[model samples]
Structures are given as structure tokens and as C-alpha cells.
Target: MSDLQVGLISLGVVLILVVLVFNWWQDRRMRGRMREHFPETDRDPLMGDVTPAPGRREPGLHLAPASGDLPAEDAVDVDPNCEAVIDVTFAQPVPSDRLHAATQALRAVGSKAVRLFAKNDNGDHRAILREGESYASVQLAVLLANRSGPLTDIEWSQLWTMAQNLAERFDGSVEGPEQARVMARASQLDALCAGLDAQVGLALRLGGTRPVADVTRQVKDAGFMLHDGQLAWLSEAGMPRFVLLYDGVQVRDVQSDGVDRIDLLLDVPNSPADSQAFSRMASVGRDLA
Candidate 1:
């Protein structure tokens, strides 16, 4: 071996070692920063020690932690903790076209589905009333959970203003619950969600060499309706009681042929979380299995 060739080889080995050491230092620095910012703990202190007033959120922050350990019920944020639905009733039946326009206006204020219902002879609100049908009376239902954490004065005023506009268009009156009553209801609901196992998730591991198509078929037959990637089960009230999410698992080995695996995740939120919900989810999973 030539001395020049041996020197070149030594330089390459030293350079490789330098690169590895640099990466190690970078990794340690990152770990230190992470520990400083987010300590390893079961309970998160950022959620708050006391629930704030309705519509009050710490400024400059928008996100509310969905699932975590709460020391107490009052520790949860009132705004994001509660969900609500409000209704606006008109004096006379509004034509389908007018209702559509009013819905568009409502959408501008808060971008969410505006449900319209018409009363039957028994005074039961029946959903899916045609926009063209003009009845003696109709109701508009607004969901406050989608846009804001809980009911806020701004949101309530927007809804009230829209109701006024809707009433003016139909030349009718607007009737609904008091704003204070709605806020009180929100607090009650948040407390209930806090007590209940608000969030529960179960994972089904598909380890067999079965095709993804077949796995999906079996899940569908299990009575789960596929929407996007989530297989959802809806309550009688038309709310999603639980959801089965599809997540692909990692294959340890790479061969000429790849293995297919679908992770079936069962996610249940406290919207109506109860023992019954958990029981129903377990039963469904067992049936699917």
C-alpha cells in the first residue's frame, strides 16, 4: 500500500467521525430543549388550575388540549370544554329560497352547518324540510361548538343579529332562549364531559397478510359507515358517538413484495361518552374480529 493512499483513507475516516459527533451533539441539545419546554408529566399545567369565564381564552393562543389528565373539573377551560346548540324560530313559514339565503348569511357569521327544521302537527321538529316548502313556522338550529370553544357574547350577538335579519325577511318574529341561560347550560355540559371518560380509544392491529381491501370490507360489514378514513358510528341524535380510524402500521422488513396492514383505531369523545358507549365500542370491535 502506498503511504499517500493510506493518508487519504485516514482523512475520510476522521471526517466521518466528526460528522457523527456533530449529530450526537445536535440530538442531545434537542432533547434538552424539549425537556425544558415540555416536561415529562402525566398532567399538563398549561390547561389551567381553574376554568375561566365563558368566551375568555388566554390571548395569543387558540388551541385547547383535547385529551389529558385534569386534576379537577374546574381545571378545564370553560370555553373549549363546552359545546352547545341554539335555535331561532320564526313567526311564519319562510320560502325555501329565503331560507337558503338566510343560511348563507349565517354561514358568513360562523362557518358551520345551519340545520333547519319544520314543526309537525304534534310540534315535533322534523329535519330535512325542503328549501322550497313554505310552512306556517320553521326553526333554525345553530351549533356553537364548531366555531368557538363555548358560547361567547360575540357569537351570541352574531346569531341574534342573523335571527333578526331572518325575521325581517320573513316579516315574522324571532324566538329563542336567553343568552344567560345558554351560557349556564354550557358550564353544566362542560362539567359533565369532565366527569365522564371524555375520550377513549382502542386500536385493532391487523398483523395478517390480508389485503387492505378485504380488511376494509370486514370493517364495513361490522356496521361502520366509511367517511374519509374514519369508520364512524352515529348516535340516534345524528352525532358521531364513536369513530374507527385507519392508520397503516410499519413493516419491519422490506421484501420484493410489501405487506399490507391496517390499524383500526376506535375513538370515542365525551359528547355522549358513558359506559354504554365503551360497551358498544367493545362489542363492535369483537364482532369485527
Candidate 2:
């Protein structure tokens, strides 16, 4: 090999080594800075005392409490008929603060909502866990069905796993209905929802394409406000009673060219029941026409 060629190869190798060493040193320095900023501690600032207290009684579980069993102020909005519930009893009464901190990450499993209720010494279940109070048991309720659809096996498993983990953490025991029963209930609930789910829409077609901005201005003037990219007609409670779409797309997505048609939709399940929903929609449709 030529001496010049060997020297050039040696230079390239040395440069590569230098780059690697520099990167390693930079990473180490950044890690040191992070450690200084966040020093390791035996007790967590959020959740203190990882160990369970001594002389805790054995955990147990039971069926969900009836609505009448809970006080009005502490009642949760969960429906026992349409929810998969798990009862968890701790080996010892756990502080509300610790329970709240532990459950911060367990609000939902996929599309299904999970609700927690704590039980006090009086056997009263409360949705809001009060600070400084200790709870003997808790109920975890997962909604079986919603607009998204029925809870699947994966979601059920996730709930079970989460419950099991929570039980282990608090030296507790969890009991819930069989997976098959939960799945069957979820299916029935979904079918019932499917029968009642309804959406009414009216289309306004123009003689020719018109500027989207002009149409939006007219809509806004007529008391429709932009919400989440779509134009919505809200009720007095600030809830959307109807939504407007431009050419099957969100009103905010229309740009450059005008639209030939606009669709007004009323989601029946979401609208207020006493608002004369259909009658009001028909009246609006006539006016728009």
C-alpha cells in the first residue's frame, strides 16, 4: 500500500474515533446535569411510603352496590346495568390521597371510560375521594357501550390487568364478573344503543358554487358558532344541538374554491330531549331552504 493512502485512511479512522468519544462525553455530561436537577430519593414526592402498613386485614370483594345504597352527594353516574364492575378491597384502609395519586393514569381503557368509587367505614360509596379520609374498599366501573361501540375482549383484558395491578399494589384482592358475561352484556348494550342511535340531516344546495367564507359569515350571523372545525348550533347550556358541514367536510377545511352544498346535522342522542329537536330542525330547514 502507498504511504499517502495509508496516512489518509489513518486520519479518517482517527476522526471517526474523535466523533464517537465527543458524542459519549456529551451524553455523559447531559446525564450528570439531569441527575443534578432531579436527584434520586427513597420517597416519591407524589406517592410516599411504597411499603404496606403492618397488621392489615385480609382483602375481600362483593357485588356492586345499588344506587339506593349510596348517598345522593356521593353517587356516581355509572349505570350498574350497563357497566362491567370490579370490586377491590384493600388489606388495610388506604388514604384517599394515595389512592388518587395511584389512579391518576387509569381513567380510561381504550374508548371505554373507567370510574372509581371509594367506600368509607359507614359502607357509603363516594365518587370523590376526600383528602385525609381512608377507604376500605373501592369499585371500578367500566362503561360497556357508548357511541364508539361495545367494549372488546382486549379492553376487558386491559381492565382486568389494571385491576389486578392495583390490587397487588395495595395488597388488595379484586373480584369481577367473568369475561364471557361482560362481553355478552356489552354486546346487548351495544345492540340497544344501535337501535336508538339516530342522526337527522338536511342539505342546502346552491344554484352554483358560492364562496365558503360568505356562507360561513351567513351561518355565524344566524347564531351558529365554529366548534372543533365544524359550525355548531349550541343550546343555552353551550352544548352543540346541531353541526354544519361543507361538502361533507368540516367547515374550516373548505378553502380557495366555494362549495355547492352544505349539510346540517342533528345528532339525536346528543341533543337535549325537551328541545323539540325534530320540530326545531324542521323549522331551521325551512328557513334555510
Candidate 3:
């Protein structure tokens, strides 16, 4: 080979080696950071094996033991729980004296996915207990998202352990749905969420003629309420059925003479997966168009 060609080949090899070394260093640094956040714990057989999968990026909750001990809250998983709606009722009514401790314990224990609810005398269910007030009975709708989707055997055990602790401390007797029933419902919900697909939108051509404020006015005039940075078209009972959002394109696109659009997204996961809801949303989109 010519001297120049040989020199070029050597340079290419050096560049490739440099890239490999840099990648290795980066990976090492990331592992160190992760360890700092999630300290090494006694490997639990219940967690199964962490096999590497191509293009897979889900975080697994490493348990300390097969005995249902929970991990640190800071290292808690961020994925949506498989069972977003767990019905938690007490076996025995919580007495007035232990009400504060019960509420605080329920609130403090478990990951963010856990939410406690109770019904008032008027038959309205709500989270966050009233101050200086006591609940006759309580319910928990713990979000099962941290363990990633469907509840594993280990995850279920951890949940039961947490529930038992709360019940023991307070006068509450933790009542959860039957294991088979809970698993079946959670599986169905996960399947629906996986197959969810519905988005309706409309583009209002301002024709570079009217001001951007007119766009907002037109949406409001259509009887859609805007609040908390979300636009919702509510039902007769004031419950938000779907969301109406202003579509954003390039920053310059919204500027003078740029195209503007709006969308009505019916999040199927949040709503019922029935033909009726889809039909209503489709009708709304058709009308807007």
C-alpha cells in the first residue's frame, strides 16, 4: 500500500479506538452516579435477572430481599403503575384518637404511586383528610406504576407488606381486592393503555390576517374552558371528558403570517375504552373541522 493510504488507515484506527475508550469512560461514570443514588443492596432473588436487551431502557426496582422490603423513595421508579386503581378499604373503622397518626402514616409510607382516599358523610370520595377531622373508614387507590405495568409476585408482596404495616399501626384493617381479581383487572387495563390511539385536531388558518388573540377567543367561544394550562370541553356534570390544546409549531410559525392549529386529544387511557367515548370525540373533531 502507498504511504499516504497506510497513514490514513492508521489515523482511522486511532479515531475508532478513541471513540471506544470515550464511550467506556462515559458508561463507567454513569454507573458510578447510579450507584450513588441506589446503594448496593443484598440482591433479592425475587427481582429475577437483569438481562441486557437491545434498545431496552426500562429501570428495574432492585429489591433487597424476597421478603418484601421496599427500596429508597429517591430511587423510586417513574413509570405508570400497572394497577392505577387499587381499592383499599379498612377492615375496622379508625378511631378518632389514632386518626392523625393513621393519616400521616398512610401519607408518609410507600412511594408516590400510593394515594389514600375516603368518603365523607355526604357520600363524596376525596383524598387528603380534613384537618382536626376523623374518617369513619378509609380507602387507598395506590398507583402500581413503579414496578412497571403489571404487578409481579414480588411487587404484590411488597404492597401487602406496606398495607400490613399501616393496618398494624392504625386501627385500620387493610382490605384489598382478591389477588386473582386485582391481577385480572390490572392486566385488562394495561392492555387497553397499550392499544390506546386517538388524537383529533383542526388547523385554523389565520391567513396572516387576524391576531393570535383571536385564536384563543374562537376556542373559548366554542364553549371550551381553559384552566391550569389545559383546555377541556367538560360534560354536563363539569367533568372534563377531553382536552383542547393549541398546537405549537416552530417558534416563528406562531409569529406574524405563520400557520396556527388546535387539537382535541381524547386520552383513551384516562377515559373509558368504549366506542361511545370514541364516537363522541370523533364527532367533536368533525364539528371543529
Cα-based RMSD of the predictions, in order? 19.6, 25.5, 23.9
Cα-based TM-score, every candidate: 0.36, 0.51, 0.33
How would you encode candidate 1's per-residue C-alpha lDDT over 43-68 as one tens digit per residue? Answer: 43323354444873221111123344
- The models' CA-based lDDT, in order, is 0.51, 0.75, 0.51
Clash totals for all candidate models? 1, 0, 3
Q: In model 3, where do residues sit more than 4 Å from their true spots?
A: 1-112, 120-124, 144-147, 197-289
Q: Write the per-residue lDDT of candidate 2 for residues 1-289, one digit (tens) a residue.
A: 9999999999999999999999779667655654454345444332344455478422222223344444445644457888888888899988777787777777778988887777865566767766556788887789999988999999989989988999999999999999999999999999998998788776767657889888888878877897776789888888887888888777767665798997888887777643355455545544454
Model 3, residue 41: displacement in angstroms? 51
For candidate 3, the 10 contiguous residues with the lowest summed lDDT are: 58-67
Indicate which candidate wins on TM-score.
2
- Full ranking by TM-score: 2, 1, 3
Poorest stretch of ten by lDDT in candidate 1 = 57-66
lDDT of 3 by residue, 1-289 (tens): 9999999999999999999999779667655654454334444222336453478422211112212343212232222334433333445545433544544544312342444555434444434334333345555455443325654445555666666775666545666677776666666665665666544433333324445567656666877786445667777666666776555442223445423566566664454333355445545554444
Please tell me which model should have the higher TM-score, number 2 or number 3: 2
